[model samples]
Target: MAIKKDMLVEKYIEALESGTIPWEKGWTTTRLHNPITGTTYTGINRIWLTFASYLKGYKDSRWFTFNEISNEKKFHPGEKWHLKKGAEGVEIKKKSIYYNEVEDKWYNSKQYYKKLATLNDVEKEIFKDECKVIGDGKGSYYIFNADEIEGIASEQIIEVDSMTVEKMQTIIENMGVGYEEVMQDKSFYSPELDAVITPPKERFKDEAAYFKTLLHELSHATGHANRLNRDLSGEPGSMSYAKEELRADIGAAFLMADFGLEFDESHVQNHLAYIQSWAEVLKNDKNVLLEAVKDAEMINDYILEMSKERQLTLTQTMEYSALDINEYHVELHGCDEGIDYTVFDNTYRSVDGGIIELNAEDTLLMNDFVEFIANERLNIDFTNYECKKADYEELMEKVETMCLLDEEYARSFNVDQMGYYVSEIFDNGEVVLDAHEDYRMFFTKDEAEMLSKELPMSHVTDNSEFVEILKSNIVNGLQTQSEVNEIYKKPDIEVLKNLKIDKPQINKTMTFGRGR
Candidate 1:
């Protein structure tokens, strides 16, 4: 299936409704990768796969296609395996893009454009054919996690020592951002003071909680006057406020993953409540969460960039993180007031959306905006093309759609991840609540004839939602209960090495949850 641009937002909506906020989940710092090749998944793949791993209790980080296992057997000549009887798989969009012969590497189309925009016209001309991506180069494929199959040895996970977590503290301390230990009960980053104020570490329930708070406040500091310069003027409960909160939560998650520390579960309850408050904005604005994640990743880029002392300890997914200018003469159009920065400014950034557009009218009003961008040591490319707001917006849409771009998953778990399930034979039915508590908790739902899979604590095997959807559809004389059964699809699994699995074909149904 073609992935929707709002795919992540749709998943977030379901997660919010289910009281299991996906972004709030704590994750390992290790980027998701194939243990077979030792190569990492980049961009959206990392974000989505991390969530998928969480959703299912796949403790082992290794995941691969059926073909990978098959190819391995050829080398070993003895070890044979198959996906555990009825084990499902997940699909990630895999696209082949043009090779940048100039760099002797590959980048997605947009990344190529930004890299090219930095060079002079001569350099740009040489890359016209060398760095283009075709629209037909995109498609989806299936892969099973190590936990999903048998006969394959799992990847051995090295337990990160205390020194690993301590590195986060050191990195944050060396960031040069202002800090204050308050006697007050609360902790926060003050934009007005350009400082992070938190209670002493002793005030927190655990060391992890204190660090999590620091990561969050520091995320806010990325918006400071001298840093990313994000607008922090929104009153609480406003859309801007909600977006900022979402951005901080996501940024903390990114940092947590890189540091390999699980988010302290102590604050999960409070964070869930906070997530509840933003439900309206998260539910209504499909693009807000996506925007927030992009912003959060940028926050991570800044914090990591500034903390080079411990850079060796942290890993970065540089595919979309680093900046290299290429020829653009690109532009964000001027309105009656010239440069509708409110819209075009953000849209102009090619890197992790640096604050190049920010602090311009404030700190650099006297300085040339273009010159400041030209001189700033930031991580993105810009030729400053003068396109209208409509044109700019359209261009972004096309780039994202054509390139399969943006904050980016795997999973053939049969349910729509709608937070429903069953618990053996209950008087209420064959399904019941699994008491989903936190994002980090994992469990199994006996999917004998229902959802036959191991799921996270967030998933209760309650089939009532499906039944309700089935009843509503049938009552309306549109779809039947049996038809709703097929809503959760079995994937079309194609092996990467051209080894396709002959899995049973499941008939289609009118999908009940998650919109396109």
Candidate 2:
């Protein structure tokens, strides 16, 4: 059935006048957050984001885009947020599924199915559901977790466990509910003492399947007198029992959405009688759906609000983390930078700026950078906070020097006879390359070839630098290269990943150029 936008708009207007949108009388789901937009996603967007967060082990559920973080448009002027250097984003594809290729048109699912029903046999077969008609156009949103961004604090971040299963397990343990995990077939709740008992996660197919049962029981637990005060005196297969179960079914579905789990309808289909009863009841009454949804929202909200307090309690005992960490203290960085780093603490004390790995990662240095400055509050013993001006200036110099002198750099080169990028093009049409950027010239031929695929059209030269420091970083175990860095070994050229063109198999005397 086609929805008349005008008629629905009129009903919505009436709903506004009457206190609520008629269809949405009790539903306004906004579980996951998009902090950059100060809004929330709905439906599949929510699920995909949640799945990404879980898979990535991101504690903060809020996500932001590259444009929003890099540009000042989303925030107040000069107040742009920063992403940790080298942090990768999760891509969420915007679905354009209604688009049809055959006959070149777009249609809603009902319209497409209705059209297929009217078609002749050949057309019907061509327009079948198995056809790759669901469009996944190039439109996609690349987003970063709030944890990836520097100085972006979020209370929703929970750090008790590594995996979502472990996190949920930890949460359940702390929620003060009577809970037990056993090696049993059935899982259930007892309202008499507000308790839940279920098989451990290992007993189920996966966390999602286990949580499906767990959330159902927890929904029942929400009905205790101290909670939502639900009436739960229903007997087996009784009307009241079905009614309560109906509320749980809806509540489980909502909770599943909030937790980023895909609802498997097979569980419902397996219990055909339960469904038939609900169908009959729904057919006889119109208000049951709204009432169930309202109650389900309440149950979902109760569980989340209660869980958050426990999550925050756990996060407090922890500290900032990353994929890799090398700690730095500004005041203690006056000496040489290494695994054995030392800094002078004669006057002012430096705060712990969290940890950072000092590796010459070319991708992070040359690519778009998120200028992260850790501002973690430290409770160190100090004479005065105001005595940091001169100390900070000297310490910042050391921090910059140490960070710049990371151990090894980007891809290594095995083949010695390859052209490399010597000049880099900037945004304002300026080509710049420092005299001391020797690390950028040590790529192997395979690395050069791979980089050639992504570079813009530019110049390549055969001039080489054999860095003595990078001799150990050649993972390809290629032949011994002539060194020429500070040790001044023989020159070995490196190809730039940003220079567009086929990898030029050139001698030291060769220089190639390209523009497009």
Candidate 3:
């Protein structure tokens, strides 16, 4: 019989759990071999997963490769594959499969699959015959059918090299542009005709130091009038202008990477040092390093795209709007503009209606906003609060306080008489109230009787305005009865009650007793 999609997915998940994946070799390092370069590298399971996700046929689901062995094999079987090298019609042999001891199954190697040529041998043959070389020299390049490289290699090529100070001076002279080096306090300047880049003379003590500075400046030039058309000629420190400076800095990193100049540990250290020094002045976020890396990668892609094509054009322009409000305007709306302002922790929204959009700037902003709102409206410091107590009274008190519960309800729990009740609380007042052992709390008479006629929480909200509501409803002013009914409504309440405490007696004497 053919396996269903859901079944296949379940099987894959089970394989993952069993450690059948070769990459999950307990604590041992995963060995990855690049068939083309004959280079071996070591990584963990997580890294292997990332590589597997980029393979050919498995692009949609990286869990399995095109060369995966059958499940019937029971044991993981290794496979060998040939990878073609550039220009040399030779295929290099490499191991592309291995058995996962944990999962007790065979899986393909992620690294080997990712390195496979995006184009088959036939596609390469077609491109080679249609394209021709153009320029000469280290930075010189060629022209090829755009269709061949459109989705193949990088969308663009970027050439980066260093030039001597004299060479730079000559280029400026030939362009007939006047320039001047700014004072020690200055960093960038733009003349009426062209922007002039002047390296701080004292900042660099040697030619290597000076060249690095010049390269950074030249990268900025690539974003000039006819190229990126970025208005970097504006006065310094303006919002738009400051953003341009950041873009230039990112551009410089892209250029450095393109030059094959290894950004070794020292280079990274120096860059980080500069970033740290500007942290205060630039209002740099210490946590934004990853975001900065992503921005740098985007800039690199753009630069490479420019290099690949002799001419470039942008087909469409997108516009965005930001609304500004004064205190009077905000008051007129009768809404606190900043009250609900929270950065969404995850901005990538799913198309399904389950996801809610928040007004936060970023994850950190959302976190701060959440805390701020909790403190202001809930009168609780969520950040400093902990749910470590196992006593029902202590846990309930904290929960009630954090959730803005009234005094009567908050004080109902008796720590000395019962064990702890602790679990997560949903925003809509639903709670997973788990009680610990050593607790002795019983429902009132009314609650026990109401339990027999209780409805599912979903049914209660099906026709009412209180969808997903969890508020208590009193019948005959009997609190115990209401509590017992609510407890019974919980799917796991019986199991939890059995584990933590004995069931209360249902005899008339106990049910009608005082303090019931």
Candidate 4:
């Protein structure tokens, strides 16, 4: 059925007026499935069915049509089937049975016979000294709750556990999102601790429903500090909170689609109302809907990266993330300047409009780099040697001189108190300690210079003498007395070894030569 936005809004308003608050009702049906086919509803149909059950106060979650209650046999010339009082006939489809001449055996045809639904209910009536059979019937078909049916074997209709459910459980565990089963009725992700909590799986309608809820919480966990770093701070009923919830809901939907899992009735109903809340909050802005979709896509992509079985698609790699990540124009090696070489985060849009994607690790590294520059946070690596802020200018000069004087100065230049180390010494001389997760360290000259130029360099050393000394030393080992004296005029090796420096300064600069 076509559902109108206005109708949904009306229902929502009515619920509020009556103090029902549909979204806050949790789930009306503890179990939701068709009694006959055992197929769970999905999408809007699921939502509608849940709402129907809630309004009618249906106790049994199982539902069946009139035809479903009947046996597979049809009437024959001598059949003794009888219709019972208030029994009904509903038109339904059944596979046609016929003889295949070539096969010489009866075969079920692909076509179905539209059979009229009928029921056989027998009863005996005693009148003084005789018995009589009586019954009443109708020509209508309707869905009835399981409670309305008789002679139903509860054990026979129980749902069987499937292999898909087992795989889903494994997938959830592999996603690396912390999950714990709690006794509470609600499921949520705690951002401060970067963990997800949910009620026991048995509490859901089925395993599929359990995974659906888990996926939602996992999506929310993506916004934690070490992940996407999404801004999730908002009052519970505020627009921002609704938007975050919307993001998680849409993300969970995407994940379900990818995993080929169907949404249960309660999930569909709850999500629809959840989305409606966001729509109301955004005043039905079309742009916000698009933004929400993009956010969902990014969250799914981020989650998919953890799975070794699935990789991101081209669109996900090049598309903008929901976070504050923007495309930056980069110069490619052999591409024209005006081409579409816009680098968005780690992935780049090639000149031919194709995406050059990077793995998750590379993408995260680039993200940290961009965040470091954008946030203007102090990020430094000191794997080579420790140095003080007061001696930064002098250290730069010495490093430059060392790089010029000896090409391999960085290798054997581990002088305890003095001397320069050459630039070719350390191949990977930088390390980002655990305490400094915000930034990376670089030991290479080109990388260090680029970092210094891009980041806040107020405390960085840019001594011109260092550059001149490097140039002069590169051309010839001979340096003018004044230049040499200027380089040596700063704190000598003895003073550096004796002087005490702050930890922040030591973290700020990487020293070369001996005075570490």
Candidate 5:
């Protein structure tokens, strides 16, 4: 007996109702659209071009790209309305469509249309505007829609009641430091260990998952300050550290259970799987599930205790002061010839028409002076020092003489009390010593005659003294290098080569006694 068109439509609806629709084997029906008219058409010959256009637009948008859309139905171009056959075939108008694949007596598309027509006004609006009937045959069809359709299609209804803004603010205020602030010192902060809760940028698709991550971080914060004080001493990979991390994980789970935040079977399964893996690592034993549970329970208890205390404190009083830090600039100067110098004062005094001034304190000055001596004396390259090893102590001592001389002379002049006077000198000598203009008269009238007689012009004419100093420094550096080489002996290549050749073979066959 042959199935009627109306009976086939009824069978398709039955299949949909029974959840027996074979979506995986391709849609039993199809849909088509006219791109120029912007009108959709369904039944036997559904235009493929319309379906392709819709798919292209949906795929191109970022919002649609992330969503999962079912592709169970397909479309194909059909004959014009004038095309027809015999009486039964004539009944089959060009618009009259048949299930391209299977025509079941109880499953068809007309029943689905009737069911859709029965929906309430609001539901009907959602279905018509948001849902698409994707099918080709006159008797069978499939439906596809956005994620929003899940709410209507689902057997369960999820009521989303947002947490109050005031409540959220209170939680954050009481949550110690915010995650962003803590992250500023990233070297010390560990998101996994510290369990610092960070609010999601927006609500998540899975609300329970979002809360789980947040609660996990909150559990970590419970260990801080005066509570559990879980060895958050910033030592990476220690047993204590691992235990603390586990405590947070367990605490989060406990909190979720306490708050009545239900999870799907899949979510619960994932959690258990992760916990089981962690347990193996924590105990190094397969049968330690009970111990892990006990640890988790303890962490949960600790969290409850800490949370109560935080709430009490927040209710009593909230006092905080803002700290303001301002930076002040200090101008520094060197000698006239650009010879590096150090200033040992907090505030620099501007002189030489504001061109020269001091830098902040003795520490900076000492550092600058040390750097200058190292650059001038050691002939050490800065880049080499970064990559290669050098004796810092040796370098320090080598420049100690110059450092001491500068310090002593600056002290005698009470340079700290009355800022040192700077001057420029011009002379065609090994060292062009520039005397200050202000102090030049004093030098010429008060001490020039006596100093000139003691250290005559002939003494200034010699260049050998400076050359001798340079030669002595080079010799001392070589001697230091030789001493270092003697202490740490290099490997001997000849001895290693001889040892390799002289090794005896273990498997040589022994001769018989008769042969001997």
Candidate 6:
């Protein structure tokens, strides 16, 4: 019989109730692999094996299906492989499908089966040319740990090594999140500090396990105020808490898959359990999965974006409050009289620059633009940036109060070719605010300083100075949800992209809470 999705969920729920969550224990420490293929499992299979091995207390992560195990092999030509002598097979549960033709329905069930292998002992002369076979090819496949097979030598089956400590460390360092290794046995993301904490690498069984656990916590870190903004304030075991776990677990899977990391059955099962635990709260909401996937995708992209934005130079290191917004380097690429920009946190303060493609006629405005930015810096603070737009009335008030300009003069300010009037700075250099098409203004501390001293003229219009002002004001800070919302949208998701979706084979009366 094959197992149904609902049954998998139920099993996970039971584990949660019993305080036997696979990830909470040492399941993540195991290095699971497929013996025959000499490859580590990945994605859902990774989670499934993690849970299975932990629950079964299997010491070795090596496993082989019945079809993959053989005492001796007699294939055509020189393509022959042999299994160790006295090798045996064990039965295990696997998913299978069944059809109820009478009711025109299909269902998944769980069943047991035997494994088979053939061997030839030429030295003993018991099976010279002919092969000696053991085990049976029962129905569905059932994976067996190598320990269950008698006389199965270690060399016959491959034991996958975890990724190197250095490699794992490098990946984590580049993930655009703060990471720390502590003496504690557990791992978690501290939203308050926007950092991830975990046990030392040596404490884990291997480097691979260490990274898997780290990835899980890193996924949670994506929900911080500066990142994905996933609400992690829910108390443990609450519906919101469960859902958040699912997001992190699933997000890790998506990331691992994209990074080409090897996952095992335990990964799949652990994630399934997480989903099951929260499925009730997420029940009938088809968008839950979609939302999680988008968040995970954003997290992945953000990591990559940060890596690209990093400009390494031998320089001094400065320390500031963890809550303080750092300087940002905004790179603007010219596109046929327009520009596209990439914004990321600045690691070095002294390195400030921008790329502007403007006609030579705009050169004079550049110096004035630089001075305007300097004066604005004297009067305003750009820390903890906020990305929002104010109404026209509020915009006028700020221009009047901060710039000391009259309403008529402020109203005469030249709108850019894009039709934007004001450029606002938020959180020091974290958020760049301007008049979006919606006519709302972003955070601006000194409206007069940000706006041109000659505001009644066309100085604010599209030109090199205006571009430099915009680039110079770019804030280096963690992107908020609103920032990500503007970057990636719902229309971007291809059917199953950014999600390790489990599409069960069973017939559905209603799939994804919608009639098909």
- Which candidate number maximizes TM-score? 1
Regions of candidate 4 where Cα sits further than 4 Å from its true position: 1-175, 282-284, 309-516
Candidate 1 regions off by >4 Å? 1-11, 73-78, 95-139, 161-169, 225-229, 305-516
TM-scores for every predicted model: 0.50, 0.33, 0.24, 0.34, 0.24, 0.34
* Per-residue C-alpha lDDT of model 5 across residues 35-101, encoded as one tens digit per residue: 2234443322121122222322222101111112221122212311111121111011122222222
Residue-by-residue lDDT tens digits, candidate 4, 242-354: 88887677667656655656555576556554555764754555345435545666676666554432222222234332111332222211122211122222122222223
Off by over 4 Å in 6: 1-176, 265-276, 282-287, 306-309, 312-516
**Per-prediction RMSD in angstroms?**
29.2, 27.4, 24.3, 27.3, 36.1, 24.0
User: At residue 355, what lDDT does model 2 achieve?
Assistant: 31
Q: For residues 307-419, what per-residue lDDT tens digits would candidate 3 score against the true structure? A: 33221111112111111111000000011222222111111111111112233332222334334445554354455532111223322333333244223333223221122
lDDT of 4: 0.45
lDDT of each: 0.53, 0.48, 0.32, 0.45, 0.32, 0.44
| Models sorted by lDDT, best on top | 1, 2, 4, 6, 5, 3
Q: Poorest 10 consecutive residues of model 5 by lDDT?
A: 506-515
Candidate 1, residue 472: how far the Cα is off, in Å: 71
Model 2 clash count equals: 10
Sum up the clashes in candidate 1.
29
1-516 per-residue lDDT for model 6 (tens digits) = 333324444555566555444333324333466745766653334444545555556566677765555533521233333434544333333334444343233433211100000222232243221222222212334456665554455533333233455554555565557788899977888877778888887998666677778778877776665554557798877777777786676666545544445666555554554545655554555345434544554554444333331222111121110111234323323343322223323322222333334442333222232333334432334443332211333233222332332222233245434343433333574222232221122223343333333232332222324332322232212343344334322222332232221224111202322121
- As a whole number from 0 to 100, the lDDT of residue 347 in candidate 3 is 15
